[model samples]
Target: MTRRNIEGSFHLSGGDFTNAGAASSELKSILTNLGINPEIVRRAAIATFEAEMNVIIHAVAGVMYYLITQDTIKVVLNDMGPGIPDIDRAMTEGYSTAPDWIREMGWGAGMGLPNMKKNSDRFKLDSVVGEGTTVEIIIRIKEGKTE
Candidate 1:
């Protein structure tokens, strides 16, 4: 893990569709500036973008934090809203509970989590019914240093 110790946070507004992916993209740029490889940065950006979209579509409001080092990057997402009931089902490739409105927004195809899993080195999810949800993802870049 790189010893960069870079951190940033984004606030996802409730029902703010236009601002989705803004923070993720910003983090991507920062990682790129820190000399993280392009491919690794792309993967982390895509995964983080998906997670951010999930927050906008499913949760009312959310926050995402990015922690970057020379060797590793960690993204933590948290939201308070209607929690996912079945994590197993949500992990499947083609399952979604998005309403008609979200579907009209062109995002209910249920590929978010799958894409995140495919792009990230480590992924974890914690959710409670009627409570909230949190997701953690970590990506490591080889040949990078950590502190």
Candidate 2:
């Protein structure tokens, strides 16, 4: 992995359904502008969007950080809110704590964390009940000469 040459951060407010995907969109644009591999970009975008949605739907506030090096893309999402009390349960494919309103809006299908894990080459999640949660996603980049 090469040293990071691109980095950015975005903040998310809880319950901001109107702007939930902004960070993911920006990250996707950045990766595209950097000429990242299409598959890697797609994976990164999916993972990021899921993480961002989790923060918007479940946390009081959060921040997302993106770092891109020659051989990888890394994303970290940290949020302050009611943390996951049962991570194992939270990781289950069809379990969700999202309210009905969120579901009515077409999100909170209990797939966010699962999809993030699926799309990321490396995924880590941690939470402390009553405190917050943090998720890290990393995607390996196949290196090639870039003009």
How would you encode candidate 1's per-residue C-alpha lDDT over 11-117 as one tens digit per residue?
99767888887888898888888777899999999999999999988888999988876568899999997888999999999899988889898898999999998
Against the hidden reference, what TM-scores do the models get? 0.92, 0.93
For all candidates in order, the CA lDDT equals 0.87, 0.90
- In candidate 1, list every pair of residues with a backbone clash: 1-145, 1-146, 2-70, 2-71, 2-145, 2-146, 3-146, 3-147
Candidate achieving the largest lDDT: 2
| Number of colliding residue pairs in model 1 | 8
Candidate 2 deviation (Cα RMSD)? 3.4
Note the clash tally of each candidate: 8, 0
State in Å the error of residue 124, model 2: 0.4
* Model 2 bad stretches (over 4 Å): 1-4, 143-147
Q: State the lDDT of candidate 2 residue by residue for 23-118, as single tens digits.
A: 999899999988878888999999999999999999999999988877778899999989999998888998999989989998878898999999
